[model samples]
Target: MQLMEVCVIAKCTYKSETIMFSVSSESSMVDILKTLCLRFRGLQLGCFTLRYSVPSYPSCFLETDSDLDLMRTFLLISNEKTVDILVKDLCGISEYSGDFCVNKELIACEKGESSCSSTVEDRNEFLGRSKRASAKPLLSNEWETYIHHVGQKFDGGAEEFRLKLCKYALEVGFNFLYAGNDKKRVVAVCSNKKLEGCSWRVYASRCEATGSFVIRTLNNVHTCAGRIRESKSKMMRSRVVSSLIVDRIRAKPELKPVEIIHEFKDYYGIDISYYHAWFGKELAKLDVHGDESKSFNELVWYTDAVKETNTGSLCTLDCEAGINRFRRFFVSFGGCIAGFQYCIPLLFIDATFLKSKYKGQLLCASGKNGNQGFYPLAFGVVDSETEENWTWFLQHLASILLPMGRVVTFFSDRNQGLLNAMGFVFPGWPHSYCYYHLKQNLISKYPKSGYGKLLQDRVINLFSRCAYAVTEEEFKVAMEELVIVGSSKVKAFISDLSRDHYANAFFKGMRYGEMANSLAESFNNWVGVFRDLPVLPLIEGIRQKLMVLNSQRRFEAEKWTTVLCPEMETRLCENAEAGRTWAVRRSNSTVFEVFADYSVMVDLEQRTCSCRLWQIDGFPCTHAVAAILAKRDSVYDYVECYYKTDFFRKAYESPIFPIPDIGKGLGSNGSAAVVCFRQLQRGQPEDHQQRGSKFLFVVVKVDGILNVGVDIGQAFNTRRF
Candidate 1:
């Protein structure tokens, strides 16, 4: 049987709709009713019945297949190409009841009224209807250029239309309020419509055919004396402003509220209050990065994800017992742990304040790479920088470092709690104090007004000379000068502090020319912008930075042809140039004496020079370079292994994998152990704090973990690492 198209008109008390469906001779009333239920949402199969409509015949229900067949046959006999049917509700009486009459002459006149040869205005009206049927929502970038016009259509329903209308009002320097607002219809008028006789208004209703909101009438002209001030307008809400600034906030998360106010005044010629701008900025940040409170709850999943993607990574989350509130978090990536073995055997530790809602401190441990670049080892977040927290952090750090059986030296500023923690955790390890901090402390004790600026500079310069002196005689000469410049109080202060911590000559361990904890300070400055973020995003941001740094350095190292890094190679060249005119006397194959202004001994076997520069800096000094030239050996070969290109490659070989976003509802495929602790109450001292419970974690990796378990999908795959 040939297929035929029929229009089924469904009517109710609220509204009416017409839907077209294809049917054949085999089609039954049951099939037609099923199709109608599917087409019209919220409709049930047994609640409505189809009725045949004809001008001459009595209106009757098409109840069975035979009735439908008879109706089709009658239509065919009458030479009609279309059949009109009505759907009536079974429970309630439909308004289209009783005899349904059709006037043929009236229908012919209506058809003639809308013919192709109609006037230009009528044809434009028909085209507007067609355009309204297929309208799309405006894009984010198109809002600046979009114009509000009569008969404009929005396919995103009433809420989107209201947002666009509000934006239009702000752009055109007018304010409006919704006179009548609902799901199906909306009416907006100027705020000064009644008082000032402003004629600006807009009316929109949902189209039954297209299910879109179309602007049926709009009066865009306003007769007001001046533009409405956005600062005084009720329509300039924080949510509306957030919608306008979300893209900018996402691009630069550190955009301040004051900057937003200036941007609005300069770009949009609108003035916004400070509080509204601040609240709007907060809302935009919340939209860009999820809620901060909810992010705390996601720590468990984030920890598991970190361990899964980057194997051997150590991530711990400490929360309050029973309350489940976050207290502390620590993370040490596998790549960093593996890479630190190739860096210098010295660590710079420091603590900085976190600018988040729940104020805390960020403790970091950094190392110096072969090229004198910053190498982050581990970091933790705690309530404050207390001895207990420092001890806890050091204990975890020991788990990674102690296994290598290499003696490491620590460098840091003088913090009493940190010093005590260092003594408690690693009793025999050598610790170096920052000379810069020591000099600041000495200057702080004496009043600048009493000593005068010139005397203070003289004392500090002598103190620096004493700290950098290579021989005992030189140290004595510098210390005597410092005492003469200052007073006996300065000598007493110097005597109280240990020389092994800051003085280069008396230090027990090799510092490799690093006298201060500047590496940690550099790291703190690098993550300054992220300190204000929540705990999870702050850590994630640091991880992303490290990931990019490693990848970039690794690629740059691949193109190198020199023995040492570029920086170390240049230093070696400068040393060789400085000692070119010196005289060299060889005592043996390993020992030599180089004479410039004075004579110094250089030993190749021990890799040391009497000047102490070669042994302390891990490279050939001027005297050693001159002796090596006398022996006709290359200076690059005499350089330490740590300064070679191979070690630099090893430091950044392992990759830091990207963590999956928890907002997408991705589950973890690996298991994690979370330790819980109860934070100390306010006014409580840290000395009385107790320990938290710890758990053992097991590692598990499942096949297709990235695809099924923690897949961020295509959205995160395109993001730069």
Candidate 2:
């Protein structure tokens, strides 16, 4: 019996009576060697005996274990020729005591005498042929070759490789680990399973993403590079500030501050995830600090940057609100109006709704002089048209105007708030209700009947007369013809007025000839340009109107001064005639001049400066200015009494408004016409729906499907779904 020697490979081993062996035909020698190294402690034996037995075949025993192991090792390590020599010397390779007779058959088969026969030369030829695995280097020593091969696999199936790459990138540590064969136009990745079914699938990673390994090849790495570059370029497109400034630049080319940013998107594509990356960096630069303490940045920039830019501003702000919106103009109880160097006594007051589309508060104001044409001087809005709103409005108004002088009188609508707010601010100041509102209210209650006409005439007459009405009784008699009872709306209105302190004072002191709030009505009519507008446009319109009005007023003032200088000189000469009428006058140490309008006489010594012109112009009117200057009084005193500090301060006092207690009004209910319809058959798909005749009655299903019928209403019947 010939016993083959066994060779042992391990890191370590313990002596034992029996020797253990493991063999595999599927793997090459190197694979087997690596597996042995992993399983055992150390290489222990050079050779060992072996015996083989199979259920169908016979058994084989090695004569000498050392010779067999040596021969096997030689077969593994040597070329074909050397293996042949070793195999020949080690004949009787499958010796079995019981199979000795059958051995002759195997020998015959080996000699090509049977179907499984093969000549020794032929066997050697088979042994010498390289196996598929043997043709390739071991994976450990051939990393580059592996990558290249895997890359080739990807090239063979590009889309499949891409899918694999995407899946792997989503998994393993290598967000992406890929190899490219630019010349072959292929890209490959190593992941969980052979990507696109390529050669390599080494998915070893510490990432917990997912343990899916795949090796995949992709076609056209160049295309990927180009796309990536395009994507990057698109990502780096326009900056934030530049983008924001683009519209501004386009709108006003002359105002362009810097480079223009054309478009944020690009040809390849846009990645929304990358927008913040680029925009954030650019926006940070917008936090610029400029020189001016009250610079535009503080106001417009701060709000625009922090709030407006991030969100968005109302589009109509400047267009509507800035250009056409009304602002409140206020004059203190005793404040004088001023224009340029002249002070005027008259104050025109009114209230209008805010133009902003947002539910804006009300806007009340003192109107500008004729020259300025109702330019608003101050402004405010409130949640409601209440006494508080009016009071707050008046107080703020008084503050703004009073510094100029005391407001001799104020004109506004008969709104309770206006009256109450004034009273709160100026306890004892004269105020006038808008004549239009008063007239409208009266006309609404009583048409042109004798009594209505008489009442209207009387109210109108009271304001037009010269002497301020002296007593409440005399004022009452003027309206004696009007109805004064539960059936009379005018009578109730009058009675209500009598109860109001401010209104009472106004009626008592009403100068029969003085025109009331006609000017305010006109001003309000002009401001109609701004009604019911969106916020941005409303604000913009108002601002623009103000700017234009102010600019025109300033221009007119300059023109009036230029044109009337010589005329005033002549007036001064005439002033010298009557007790030496001086062109200028001094009143309580302040000087004023009277200009134009030759109507009233100017008495410098008496401090009786008139032209009533001062009231109309909101300035001293050349005559008053001239008169005051004659006395060398600095021509400042007669500056409209309203402009004086005492009066000006009074304008700041709150105005008063009388709020009516809310209650149900007469006749609350009413009815109007309406229409109804229904549908009939439905569910089945049809080419088109039949149109129903105008007056035809049709049965309609609850679902709105209609069916044609002679009288659908009478024939209506419910159907189960």
**Highest lDDT against the true fold, candidate:** 1
lDDT of each: 0.72, 0.36
Q: Write the per-residue lDDT of candidate 1 for residues 29-121, one digit (tens) a residue.
A: 667766776877655434445565543543456766777778777766776555545554332222121232122222223234534355566
The alpha-carbon root-mean-square deviation between model 1 and the true structure, to one decimal in Å, is 16.1
Residue 283 alpha-carbon offset, candidate 1, angstroms = 1.6
lDDT (tens digit, per residue) of candidate 2 on 1-721: 8544434321111111112344322323333333433544432111112232112211234333343454355444532112111001111122222232223333344445578858688555334431321432221121111221111233224333344334322211222344543222334433222433323322211112322222332221111111111222212223423333344433432231222222223211222234443343233223221111112112222223222321211111111142221222212111112331132234566655543222334354545332223434444433235566577666665655566564455666666656777778977776656555665665665447787677666654543221133344543454453343323565577666542323332342322223466655666665565543332233333545644555544443443432223333344345434423433333445434433434444554444445433333334444654555465565544433433433322332222111122111111111111111112122212222133213223222323333333433334343322
Total backbone collisions for each predicted model: 0, 152
Predict model 1's lDDT versus the native. 0.72
TM-score of each: 0.68, 0.33
Which segments of model 2 are wrong by more than 4 Å? 1-346, 354-361, 370-372, 402-408, 449-491, 498-514, 561-721
RMSD of each: 16.1, 30.6
Model 1 spans > 4 angstroms off:
1-162, 177-189, 193-235, 444-451, 488-496, 666-721
In model 1, where is the ten-residue run with the lowest total lDDT? Answer: 692-701
